[model samples]
Target: MFFIMIIILSITYTDSYANSAHSAIVMDVKTGRILYSKNISAKKPMASTTKIMTALLALEYGDLEAFVKVDKNAVGVEGSSIYLKYDEEVKLKDLVYGLMLRSGNDSAAAIAYHISGSIEEFSNLMNKRAKEIGANNTNFKNPHGLHHKDHYTTAYDLALITRQALLNEDFNKIVRTKRWISEREGYNTFYNKNKTLNQFKGGDGVKTGYTRAAGRCLVTSATRNGMQIISVVLNDPNWFNDCYFLMEEAFREYSPEKVITRNNDIKSFRINNGKVERSYMIAKEDIVIPVKEEEKDKIYIVFECNETYEAPVRKGQKLGKAKIYIGDRLIGTTELFAKENIEKRKLIDIIKNFFSK
Candidate 1:
């Protein structure tokens, strides 16, 4: 592999509230870049933030319009609750809304049981989903995140989980909501506990968690100027303020820059044993990188291809790849494809060209 080195200019900022959180991280939602980190990998209880994964699985696998019969186990499971009653019929989507907006432990259990038949099985699914989303340090013991010895996730892992959850439109819609009224008769209106949704500019969907052992844990997301960021803080006394500061820092520091566009012509490669002398290649898709505005100039593109190819090359055939970098870090990559066909030269044509030469 050829190494491409990019030198990005670093920005200077004061760390005034760094000590507020025991573990924390701020990540770019689009690029999955870590903008700020403090003991981000430390294993800690995520409290109700584990509901993010629960909500994610429900949205992905359950039909929103379908009504789930509230199970007996879902009621009175502990922590905050939407006070779902046993055998009450509720829409899956409404339960999700209640789960996220209200931080309802009862809602979480109902979703867990409806989707996977039991809390233990749903916890297993949450763990599987965590690993699938690259949150390796996470383990889920229950969907409500009520506190179990094995129910723990790092700040970085929670950020990773939130990033994945934010990609779902339904998940985004639910978490950003400030208030939701259930259609059920006599049901109390659910209000979001995540204050950042209203308090912070550009703030969107995410979850908040707290327990005596977990302290205050929060995962918040916000979007500004087309760039979205996710911030996670575990066991912070000033969770809201800390997340706000981190988000502002990321938005102020970084901007998304388009590096390449699909089908845009790149450098031509020499073609051997073909009617054409060169093959033009284009990027397979757009590649965007999030970087500091001042450091945008340091973004580099390196194209790697074989010296020559024996063609008949077909249009859109993969030829090589374009690698993008920022300060020695590989940020993105896209395959380079032949823009047009290049048929191999016929034997008779080769003979005639030889004679002419």
Candidate 2:
């Protein structure tokens, strides 16, 4: 029986998943919110999805225009290769195309050696980057996602890494390309093995992977109707089918909602002791949430206020919290602050004002 549930794509995880693989996670790229999660914290062999982090580190540390010499160690290193022979003179850009598009083990090693002088050193960089990106549950033992007893990550962690990668305009451009041809020594070209990049509509890219141990694995991203969703599936017999279905459900059910805008007056409240009787509070910045198209009206916002406050409340002072609710569930929260200041009303001033009255 095929089971499907609609997630509003909100910041909170909705009950919209079924038994599959070891772990799975669907996240909104903008807010870093998990729209759906199942064992997201559980770590497992992520296969080639590890390349997302590899690509990220390479983009940051490895220069794309720099040329790299394919070393002997990078040659004949197991699984999903761009088939690079030893001593190949290829630009880093071409190697990345091979790395991300072809999921080339050869390209991964070439990148590692060129950037860090050795694969072991590059793996160290990968682990450092993983920690910097807030992926505590993840660890990298290699640049290529070839099955390593020690290299592993969770679906949620993969989502976290991809979201960070997408923010790098350069990284996004590389992943979205349909095909890349590299000219070196002679003219060798490699086609992207990511079938979803061409087969599915709005398929931007990401990467695909597999091993005898890490069964059909994939990380997919797409944008439709102004909504972008990222899906990570590991160890599934039908990774593509599951991802497609999940994306369809996400875009079909939800759309982006602007909860508050910067500098916009939120609400007015009375001050106990101040120069101003009432002050209008405005949002410091905009807050947007993803919600079901049908349930847009159900989205609710509540203002929280401090019970008491003294005079001299400075502008931008935290006064309370903004609680966001959707269908009785708390999806997100924002800080509420005083937009302006208030002065103390002294007793002498009050007495003089009363006598004059």
Candidate 3:
């Protein structure tokens, strides 16, 4: 929860702030699956959520413990900032907290310079990483997500980027943190800017943004019932509430089901010319998938294998494949392996097995 947070808005849209998203999406955090979307691919200026990429680059490339000498060019950056001063030194990690919790544009600048020498260079890194994460619709012109004609991303792209960022343990800790006190200097204490962390159940991360051009843009994430959902709203007047609604809708509609368990016996199949009467097949990977309760009947597992395999079949030998389907969509597939060795049948072997039995 954001025990302390201050709201900053580009325009006061309080009176008619409902369903004002130009683009939006709700994605499953674990699977990179888009559960809901509205104009998800339409690119628009994404105010401060761009800091997600900035913070990510810092976490990946910069040493959090390293001291960053705030560049003169990095000072007094437009929009939200931790108010970095020229030549002031701060820890890379704390800057990230400021970047995420406070939406510090200056913190983003300092980290950029510290990591890539110039904001342009850092923006290149950001674009590179965005592509690596499959954010094909994203193009970053700056680190802070300030309004720029070339600086833009889609709701789908933001969800993909944030999903990858959330995978990092340190990145997870930093964004989810409610409050962080700086040990260095100047406005040392910061509160979260992501108010969804305070207002919504299980809400932890993400960021908030607004610009005269971009309107209200937000990325929010929450975990409920062991399912983590991420919502992105761009140019929304009611960003927080909309994100909450999307996450809640996802939770209500989808729940995880264990479709396959690793090394667990899946089925018994006929074994021809084998000492054993049957051969057991086991799954090699665990597959837990989120599906709607109503679709449970539609979900089915199909096994593809020969009716019988001529032994000797060794333990762990690949036997078949099991595919999971949700209606017509094939969701996942796993190879089936022999659970135990089954030697070729022989008269002497049959007599020995009979005596052992």
TM-score of 1: 0.82
| Local accuracy of candidate 3 as per-residue lDDT tens digits, 1-357 | 100101111222232224668898887765565677778889899999999889889888989898899999989988788988899989898899999999988898898889999989999999999998888889998899888899999998898889888877798888888899987876889898778778899887888888999999999998876667789999888888888877787787789777777778787899877987786798765666668888788888889897788888999898888877778776656678899999888889778877999
Please name the candidate that would achieve the greatest TM-score relative to the true structure: 1
Sliding window of 10 residues with minimal summed lDDT for model 2: 1-10
> For candidate 1, what is the lDDT?
0.83
Q: lDDT tens string, model 1, 1-357?
A: 111112222334356536589998887765677787888779998888989999999988999999999999998888788889999999998899988988889999999999999999998899999998888899999998888888899987898788888878788888888999888767669888888888999999688889999999989899887678898899999989989988887777778787776678786888877998886888765565668777788888888888688879999888888887776777656678889999999999889989999
Off by over 4 Å in 1: 1-17, 261-286, 303-322, 334-357
| TM match of model 3 to true structure | 0.77
For model 2, give the RMSD to the true fold. Answer: 7.0
- lDDT: worst 10-residue window of model 3: 1-10
| lDDT of every predicted structure (CA atoms) | 0.83, 0.77, 0.82
Model 2: runs farther than 4 Å from truth?
1-16, 259-288, 293-357
What ranking emerges by lDDT with the best candidate at the front?
A: 1, 3, 2
Please give, for residues 218-327, the per-residue lDDT of candidate 2 as tens digits. 88888765456788888878788778777777776678788877677787777766776777666675677668777789989887875467776788887777777777
Q: What is the lDDT of residue 27 in candidate 3?
A: 77
Clashes of each: 2, 0, 0
Give residue 4's error in model 2 in angstroms.
28
